[model samples]
Target: MAEELQTATDKLEDEHYPAYTMGRAAEMLGTTPGFLRSLDEVKLLVPQRSRGGHRRYSRYQLRLATRVRALVDEGTGLEAACRIVILEDQLEEARRINAEHSSHQPER
Candidate 1:
């Protein structure tokens, strides 16, 4: 029982865990459910679905949503904002990979 409880607690710390329901996620982002749904429509941040088929979001998804929200607030179009976020994510990943590769290279 203690192990189960610990595992549940550990999941909460996981950034990829689908811990927040749509409504809660929207509320956290200061947006409406419709906005989140729009994100899914645009194929930006497709959240996980619960057993009953309700959308559930992870902390990483919320971070992406927050970036989109900021862009939209700054007068960017929804589709453009999603594109920018995708590019940004890709660039970050590429940079991470490059850094890791550099660290493993032998000295000149």
Candidate 2:
């Protein structure tokens, strides 16, 4: 009974999680599997891996891939484009966090 309950719980968790396999992620992002793997190899987009060694991509990764595609469409090389995109994304995220933090602070 306990084992069955645990299995059910695990299934529920999996269903609620935003996890995607490599092939599914590629399809969602409108890219080839090889291209996704190359992005990972280049450290442009790293996905979470399961204990069994399967790749799991999140929604964040799919968004990043879309950004990468846009940059490429703008005539940027893959490596350079990825670097620029990552830097810009980091800066934007930092600014957003800072803005949220400052909004919560007591105004002078």
Candidate 3:
């Protein structure tokens, strides 16, 4: 029982674990599988395939999908939304790296 609980707990926080099947992911995102397929077509978030040839999504991918869904709900074209999300992500990573580098620098 404890082991089962531990496994569930780990899955709750494992960002890269391919835990969600296509139907489940789509349901959770309040969208359809075709929508996810469209995102895949644009190379926005590629899901991992299970050994039995099912598409599996991780938490990270779900987050991206959620962002895309939000943008699409706001009337953004899928391709443009993908580009915007990618740019936002890149900008965020740059800010993080800059902050880390600034913190590591010694005062002159």
Most accurate candidate by TM-score: 1
lDDT of 3 at 46: 87
Tell me the tens digit of each residue's lDDT in model 2 across 23-96: 89888878889878878999987787889888787777777888888888799999987898899889999999
lDDT of 3 by residue, 1-108 (tens): 999999999988899898999999999999999999998899998899999999999988898889988998999999999998889888998999999999999999
Ranking by TM-score: 1, 3, 2
TM-score of 2: 0.76
- Which pairs clash inside model 2? none
TM-scores across all candidates?
0.93, 0.76, 0.85
lDDT of 2: 0.83
Give all candidates' CA lDDT scores.
0.97, 0.83, 0.92
Give the residue spans of candidate 1 off by over 4 A: none
Q: How much lDDT does candidate 3 score?
A: 0.92
lDDT of 1 by residue, 5-102 (tens): 99999999999999999999999999999999999999998899999999999999999999999999999999999999999999999999999999
